[model samples]
Target chain A: MLELQDISVIFHPGTIHEKVALSHINFRIEEGDFITIIGSNGAGKSTLFQTISGAIAPYQGHIFLHQQDITSLKEHKRSRFIGRLFQDPLKGTAPSMTIAENLALAGCQGHYFSLKPILAKQRQQMYEALKELNLGLEERMDTKVGVLSGGQRQALSLLMATYAKPQLLLLDEHTAALDPQTASKVLELTDKIVKKNQMTTLMITHNMQDALTYGQKIMIMKEGQIIDVINSERKKDLTVEQLIHLYSSKTNDYNDRILL
Target chain B: MLNQVVVIGALELGSIFAIMSLGLYISYKVLNLPDLTVDGSFTLGCAVSAVMTLSGHPVIGLILAFISGLLAGVVTGVLTTKLKIASLLAGILTMTGLYSVNLKIMNDSPHISLFDCSTVFTPLSVFGEYGVLLFIGVVVIVVTLCLHYFLKTQFGLALRACGDNEDMVKASSIDVDIMKMIGLSLANGLVSLSGAIYAQHQAFSDSQSGTGMMVIGLASIIIGMAFIKKDQMAYQLLAVIVGSIIYRGILTIALQIGIPSTDLKLLSAILVVVALILTKVKMRRKEVC
Candidate 1:
């Protein structure tokens, strides 16, 4: 299980322009539990993910992975345990690299980059993985990733993320860039891969439908604080309207927050 | 007439520039930054190598040249990454700083001469006739190939990712600062290593020799990448080597045709501009078609 204890983050802290991006964020995610996070603009959803991924350390709080305190670990050290996919398709994968190279890189988990050629069996394994994407990417393994369309790139990014099965996967609006069809395809692929790996994941999505459909748990955030948490049992009876009602009731009663 | 000796000279010259170009490629293409420090660092390589060779250690000179360049590159990286300076300005700052550092390393002078020393290639005369070029060519090829293979490895992937997207690389658990440090240092190291060889080949290490070297390296990279099929790493490296030769070959041809030596700079700029335009054109075509 992953846990965040009283996580608080302040931007431009102690200055006149100080803004609390997150305040005393406390949450828990169990292993193999897929969670979807929903929040409007400036709701601290992105900030929460950034903090969790070790991109931005919390000013106050302790983060633990499987009961091991990971708050002090550096970003790369954290990466050994967590995998992330960004909203921008171009952000996750190297554009200049070929599909095969990208896969090879993922296969290596970005380690030993200066030694060892991609072995034949590894190459075949990567090819087989790409083949499941069913985009004919297996045939275009040698093609540069820059030449790919947004959907294709996002799919490739998904593959790269899952290739090195980390304990926790972070999807930061990963399908936000593609067309509806492509996004649906990528989401399908995501569902398949996430299930196949049985990986614990925290996925943040702006689409209300998406949040309702995926992940065993759903979270709503207003300020830095999580307002509601719905588990699989409770979420089964929940609808988009009920989710919005739950989010609004808690946020409206809070008084200080001007929800976006 | 393409005289055999001149052809060999062009190849040898190209090989040296190829090393510099590959180094520059890492900084520019991968890091996505304009690194002016390569100019001073190139000379640093030469001065260190020349001084070392003069003191009777050619291998030490070569190794030292690489290390010196690598250190200089790291300084540039530090200036940008840790200090949060703009990339171009950081490079310029380091480049200016290297001017003095090079002088100090060379004992308060901006130049050194390895007039009668055993450089890595200096003792290669025993090969009889095509000795120097052959030996340097082999060294260049082997080193380039090794780097090429290295880039295909996992560490190299992380390094490339650092250049392409620092945020993503950082998210993946690689320190962006550390990767940038390696990129800058390694890039300049290659350039300086070539400079060291150039110093020993011509038997002089002058500060002026480094002037416009960054531009020359960029020009070589642009020319190489233009012809190199994008996405083909091994061939891309080979193209850089070939591009350096072609670039040098053009200079030689221009000289043979009696073009005034003073016009070389203007010509280089024109060549780079043309290549840049072509790159845009190709990219745009990809969008349209």
Candidate 2:
């Protein structure tokens, strides 16, 4: 479980160019809670994820993971218990390194790196995991990730993120760059992986259908604030059209293009 | 007879510089950092080794030289990582600072001569001119093998990841700053080792000896990579060593053909320019393919 209290992020504070990115945002995530966050651009969705991952320090807030204060933890230190996937597949994996090497790196969470070999067992595990994606990555374990297609790279990125089973998984529009079919495939895998691990996940997506279809909870955001959070009971029966009506009614600044 | 001497001398010096090129490979190629500190640390190594050897501690001299190189790298790493200075600027700052430190280490002298001092090569003196060659060859092999093995380790993989994609490394819970510090230290340490041995081999350590050393190392790396299959980590390292030798051979040939010794630095710059241009062309061709 993770919690953020009174979180605020201001860019270039006290200057004419100053803008509040996140403001007094409070959020709590329960164990095994799969949260799908929907927001238009500048809604502070990425900032919230960055704050949780310790990439950006909140100007005024406290972050807690499992009842432990983690606001001051460095980004790399926070990553031990937090797995993150970025919108750009290239950002999530090392392109110059092989798939096996990337998996080996992910598997090293919470463990000291030693001089010992990465082990054949670790490679075997990576191969099996890649084989599950049905992307033929198992046959090219030694191939540099740079040569892989975007969908294949994102799939491998997903595998790397969850390989260690971190306490919290953060996906920031991870499938946005893929084509429709590939995006759906990745989303399906995301759903399967989350269910299999019972992972506490926070995913941000612009796709209204994806928002309505996945996760036990759905939260809508506007202007650095969470306007509404529909729980599993309400979320099970919620329609995209109704969600859009509720959003437009609340914000009064409807952007129909976001529904796509 | 003169050609044979030139060839042998080139090989001897080339092997010594191969160690330095390997160090540069770690910083420039592996870590993706252009560390100019090598320009000073190489001389610092020679200064420390020369001063220590003159005082009858050849082994201690080498160890101290390596340690000093590590400290120099730490300074650069801290400046770049903690102070958030640009890596190139940090290297320049450290290199400038090391100038005075090198002078101080040499007791205010610009140069030290170990001509009469016993060195690591003294025990192999019975092999005559081959002593220096043998000593340098063994050292290069040991350093290369150790580096090859180290790069294959988990820690080494993390270090490589730090260079290739720092965000991915951070996401994996590996501290990018610490990895950079460790890598810089190891790289500069090897460069210093090269300087230390060079001081003993040449029987002199001048503060200016390390001038243009970075370009030389870069040239060697670029040339070596062009000749070798770079897909494997081990082969890439071997390429650096071989590149150093070939670089030296080219310089030797230039000298044999009546090129002035004073123009050697110009030659080094030209070599780097050509190597870089060739690399760009190759990359462009690959893209076209």
Candidate 3:
């Protein structure tokens, strides 16, 4: 389980450009919880995820993963237990490196690096993993990742994120850049991988349908706070229309553009 | 006879400089760090080697030269990574500081002559004219093979990743600072070794010998890249060595064609500019295609 106690992230605390990105966000995530986060732009959703990943330090808070205080851990150190996929397809992978090399790097996550060669056995394992996606990436193990399409790259990113079997997985709008069909395919793959590993996943998505279609729990964020969290039982019975009705009533903002 | 002499001399010098170019390849191309410390480290290598050889320990001289270069690189790496100084500025600062350091190493002398000293090449004296060539050729080959294998390892992949995408590297749980330090240290160490070898070959080490070394190394790398398919890492390194030889050939031919010695630096500057422009034009054409 992960816990955040009085997490507050303030950018430029005293200057004129001072902005409260996250204000005293207190939340807890149980083990094996698949939570999908939905919010408008600048609603502190990304900030919340960043705070948890140690990319951004909270002004006043303590974060714990399995009762181990990770509030002051550096990003690279925290990466041992945390896997992340960025929204930009280019962000998660090294373009100039080959597919097999990237997978090799992923496999060595949280481990000491040696001068040993990437063995054939390791490459074979990676090929099998890529074959599961059915993307034909297994045939192009030596090809540079720069030449891959956005969807293919994101698929590889997802595989790399889950390859090391971290304690938590964070996907920040990972499929937002792909076309609708590709996005759905990636989403399906995400569900398959998460369920297979029984990973504790927190996915941020703008699509209300996706927010509803996947994940066991749904948390709505607004103005740097978790305003509403719909649990599994109620979430199963809820529809997109009812969710929208609740959102409109809670914020009193009837703009469809804001929710979408 | 004159042409043959020019060609042989060029080959000898080219093989020596090829080592330095390989060092630049690591810092500039692999780490993507613009390290100006190369100039100072080159001189430091010469100075240390020359003094050690003068003290009757030629082999120890070469080893010390490499160690000194590594120390210099570590200073630059610390300045850039830990202190957050701009990489270029950090290199420049180290280069400037090394001026005095090199002078001190030579006992405040601007140059040292090893005319009667026993160098690594001395054992091969029976071969006469081909001795230096054979010695340098073997060194370059061993260095190339070692580097080729090193770059294929896991540490090498992480080092390359640091240059390609730092965020991805950090996300993968590799320490970026340590990688940078290791890269810089390795680069400068190779550069100094080249300098040490050159001093032993020429039987002299001048403090000013490394003034335009960075330009020469860069020009060699650029020239080599132009002649080879650069998609593969091994081929790219080989191309850099070939480029160094070709660059030396061109320089020797220019000198033979009656170019004054004083204008050599100007020619080096112009050559770098042309090489850079050629690379840019090729990239633009690729984009258009």
Candidate 4:
């Protein structure tokens, strides 16, 4: 379980250009809950992810994971349990490293100081994992990831993030860079991995249909505040049109790009 | 224009410098850091080796030199990572500070001679004419093999990845700062070790001996990498060794052509610039086609 209490983030604080990125944001996420977040541009979606992942410290708030306060933890230290993926596919994996080597890095995350080589057993495990993706990446385990397509890289990035079965996963527009077909493919893979691991995930998406179709709940954010959260029961019968109507009715800000 | 002895001497010098090139391989190639501390740490190694050799502990001198080099590297690493200084400026600052530190290590003397003192290679002198070369060759090979295996380890993978993609490494729960520190420290350590050996081999240690050492290392890497064009660790390291020898050969040829010894540093700088320009032009040509 994770909880954010009175979280507020002010960018460029004390300056004339100061803006409240996130204001008094509070939420409690249950174990294994898949929550899809929807918002227009500058709705503090990515900023919320950064605050949760310790990438950006909150101006005022407290965060608790498994009932322990983790607000002051460093980003790398918090990464032991929290897996995060960026919007840019290129930001998530080492381009110069081979697929096998990248997987080895993910597997040996906390034990990074070990002098042991990537053993044969570990290589076999990575091979089987990649085979399950059915992308034929297993055959190219030694290939440098630089030449991989955006969708392929995102799929690989998802695999690396969840390889250790992190307790909390944050996806900040992971598939926004891919073509429609590739984005949907990577999204499907993400859904499968998150379901298989029963991981607690918070995914931000601009596509209204995706937010409606996936996840157990839909969270609507406006002006850095949670306006509404439709539960699993309500989310089952929610339509994209109805969700968009609910968003516009509460925030009065409508954008055609979110329909995509 | 070259004698057999001069060729052999060049090979020996190449092998000794190859150890230093291996350090540069880690910093410049693997870590992608243009660490200018090489000039300072190289002399630090020489100073420590000289002082230790004069005290009748030649082998211990080499170990101390490597350790001192590691410390110098750590200073640069701290400045870059902890203090948020630019990497280039950090290296320059550390190099400048190490000048006084290096002299202090030498009891404020700018030069020291080991004419009567024994060195790590002294014991191997029994093998006669080829003894020094053989000893240096073994040392280079051992250092190369150690680095090769180290980079293959899981920890080494993290370090390499830290250079390749810092964000990925941090997200993977690896400390990028610590990795950079380790890379810088090891690079300087090996470079210092090379200086220690050079001092003993040449029978003298001079504070000015480290000038333009960074360019020399870069020249070796550039020349060697152009040949292999492969990403494998074994091949890459082999390229560095070959590059060092080739670089030394180029200098030998320059000397043979009647270039004064005093102008060797200028020649090295010119060679590096030419090599870099050639690489850029070749890359542009490839892109055009």
Candidate 5:
């Protein structure tokens, strides 16, 4: 449902310190496509996500969603259809606010000038949704999000990002900072939510096994280009060893985090 | 050691100042903006109220004062958000420019005496000596309730989140710039309303009356919040009002001890500095525990 044509992002252009973050990138995200991106540092994966989400305007090219140009839409306006989660759990939720309030904010998305208070129906919906996370958060909806563990916060972030049911969801290393157990737990939650809602999602990760395990397609990036995209058929029989071999064969470089 | 009359007078003035503190509570506490526009907007309220009261429309004067205050906040908001001016500098620029605007509003006069004019309090004389106090007390309560309700609304939730975390607010599909502008406008509007009430209470409006006003409001907020440990909004607002009264009470004691009125501004600055140091020390101690 989303397409990027010849997108490029150059930082400090024309200066001696100029560096190209993305170059002549082209990609199409089909409806309900769960795309997992694997890239080394400076591979332009995050930059590509930022460009599509409107955080940074691409130096060149056009972005179309559902065949309509939204290249010039402001970041906040574009957020109506694009839900984003960052690596930092703290970045997604307000620490000082309660869990229910955070959920309320996410549910009220796209109503820019609304003065309506949280309705009883919304509170009930939030309670039901939190219960589904199985985090025992429903009973403590009044508790501030700050005191929650990193895993809980990320799970909550996932729910909030998908609560309003955006047209596209962007997950940028959302579980990388958590403990391995918590990371896997959050990943499972992510999988369940995306499947239940059928959300079109793009998740960035350095973990090779995760890259091979989840999502319908694995997009491999090097330098500033999408070098390969393994479809669902190819992904079914792909192993970590084979994926690593496929990556190093293209770039002749091996990174430790990606292997992990 | 103070008598009932002096205590009542302090409360009347305290109630007036509480209105301004409520404004400061939004800008400084909720929105996390240091809005120096408080100084300029407060005086703008007095100037507008004075001109309006002189024209036999004390009620309209109050309404206009609040509107003027909102406009002052808008200017500061525009400078900080659109023009990329720092919040402190934006407030300073607005306050400095408002000096001239305040003068023009007062018809080039530095002060206006409302001694013989009718005020909102004049019609309540039949309630005897405590008429003004009773009226101001009810107004403060009404304002506190309205403000509390507003803060609980979904829009207020977004505003608070904007202050708490701007990125999250943006990710939630809310515009942070527009929220900040609306917040500052509301904050300064309440401050101007306070100033209008102050002019009516004191029977005069002076251009220099707003001097050190921002410090005074900060001191009241800091002192009040120090006593209120709960994160609940209602208790926090009550602390502001009580802190204002306590600040006024301390000033009364200072006067009774024969401290010169000229030294009061110095005292206000010192009080704010002391309160800040205390709160910092308290926070550090908590972290240690």
Candidate 6:
């Protein structure tokens, strides 16, 4: 469903502050694949996600989505096929909108905007989706999102990210900010929805345990290098300490030059 | 006699100021940006609409006013979103540039008058004595209602999102740049619309009409919000409308108590700053308590 070939991204390439964030990176994922990426700080985790989502152009390489080259597409254009969740809870959803209003925006994707109100049918559909989250947020169809709790907002954001039913979901630590229990619950909801929808997903996580436990594959990034790629087969047998060992050894030489 | 004019002056001036406040609501309330372009675009609207009205085509005058205001707004959006200029500086620059643009657009005429001219409201004025005030009132109510309807639509939701959370909207696959452009256009439309109405009603559009308009709008919005606390559509809509009326009322009462016309701008500025501070302090106190 997604492919990145020999992608090289350098920031300020020739300037005094020039640094390589991603260097000749190659990666691939099959359709219906859910890949969890784990990386320490400054390992270009976010940058990698950005590159895949076309937030930033990869300095060198072709990005393919389902087969078409999408490297040159702008973030908004690529967004139709991709859904993203940021680490910051406040960043993932409009805080001042009703849940339904936010969902309506996502629902209206790829359609020409007219002077009409959100259709009654679309609102009913949104209500059903909100109800399924089990957050008791469906009643909040008219509530301003700014008044929602952080966890609720993040969940709503997750729901919005999926509202348009994108081909790929990129979760950039979506649950990283929630209380542990809320985080766990959100992840559970994520699992259920992603499986039901069979969405091709790539989620970056700082939580090593989460990386190992969720998703069909686990990939460790170290200094812009994919130190190890483990499929469900390998992921099942892996442990956190062992994965850390692999990451340190493979990326030791580039640790000093680590760039996010 | 002077006191009577102050009563009339307060309502008339307040009504005009309401126009700016309504525009501010779009940018600040809906879009959540401290857009400063209004100061310039209000004048831009007045300039175009006033000139066109004086030339005997007030409908075209208003349309041109809105279009020109939209252009000024786009320039501000580009400066901030595309050029990465700071919000405050972008507004200041736009306002400065508009001085020259207004001059050129008006054939370097310092002012334009519609004393003998026909405006969008000319036909409505067959009622005679109440013509000017009635025209302004109808314009405000109609435009506000249209905006109320517009803000309830899907596109409006996205525009609101663009204000509160750009990332989420982007994640949802909505383009923030396009939203910003459209938002600014709509916001400035309200401001320029006010300017257009003000031009015809006053029978003159001076380059100075738009000066300090931002402050006046803020004052009205702050006052309006003070009266309406619910986040529901009706409340928000009511807040802008009532806030405008009350703001004008306060100015009227103050003028009745003997404040000079020359100090109205100063009074408006003080009104805005004080209202802003009061709201901030109230919110803070609520959080603390």
Give the best candidate by DockQ: 4
lDDT of each: 0.83, 0.90, 0.91, 0.91, 0.91, 0.81
> DockQ, per-model, please?
0.60, 0.78, 0.77, 0.88, 0.80, 0.61
Better-scoring candidate (TM-score), 5 or 6: 5
Q: Which stretch of 10 consecutive residues in model 3 chain A shows the poorest summed lDDT?
A: A251-260
DockQ for the candidate 1 complex?
Answer: 0.60
Error of 6 at B260 (Å): 1.9
- Residue pairs with colliding backbones in model 1 are A76-B173, A112-B154, A112-B155, A113-B153, A113-B154, A113-B155, A113-B156
Q: Which ranges of candidate 2 are over 4 A from the true structure?
A: none
Candidate 5: stretches off by over 4 Å: none
Worst 10-residue stretch by lDDT in candidate 5 chain A?
A: A251-260
Name the better of 2 and 3 by DockQ. Answer: 2
Per-residue alpha-carbon lDDT of candidate 5 for residues A1-260, written as tens digits (9 for 90 to 100): 99999999999999999999999989999999999998888899999988998989989999999999999999999998999999998899999889988898899877756777788899999999999899999999989999999989999998999999999999999999899999998999989989999999999998888887889999988888999999999999988999999988887777676667
Work out how many backbone clashes candidate 3 has: 0
- Model 6 lDDT tens row, A1-260: 78899998999989999988998999888999999987777788899998988878888999998789998988888888898888788887777677777788878776526667988898899989999999989987888888898899888878888888889999998998899999999998888889999999999887767777789898878778887888788777878776666666666633421221
Q: Give the TM-score (0 to 1) of chain B in model 6.
A: 0.91
iRMS (Å) per candidate: 2.0, 1.4, 1.3, 0.9, 1.2, 1.6
Candidate 6 CAPRI category: medium
What residue pairs clash in candidate 3, if any at all?
none
Error of 3 at B105 (Å): 0.9
Candidate 4: residue B225 Cα off by (Å): 0.8
Which consecutive 10 residues in model 2 chain A have the weakest lDDT in total? Answer: A251-260
Residue B194's lDDT in candidate 2: 91
Better of 4 and 6 by TM-score: 4
Instruction: State each model's C-alpha RMSD to the native.
Output: 3.3, 1.4, 1.4, 1.1, 1.0, 3.2
lDDT by residue for model 4 over B168-203, one digit each (tens)?
887779988998999999999999999999999898
B183 in model 4: Cα distance from truth in Å? 1.0
Q: In candidate 2, list every pair of residues with a backbone clash.
A: none
Please identify model 6 stretches exceeding 4 Å from their true place: A239-260, B1-9, B116-128
Q: Choose 1 or 2, whichever is better by TM-score.
A: 2
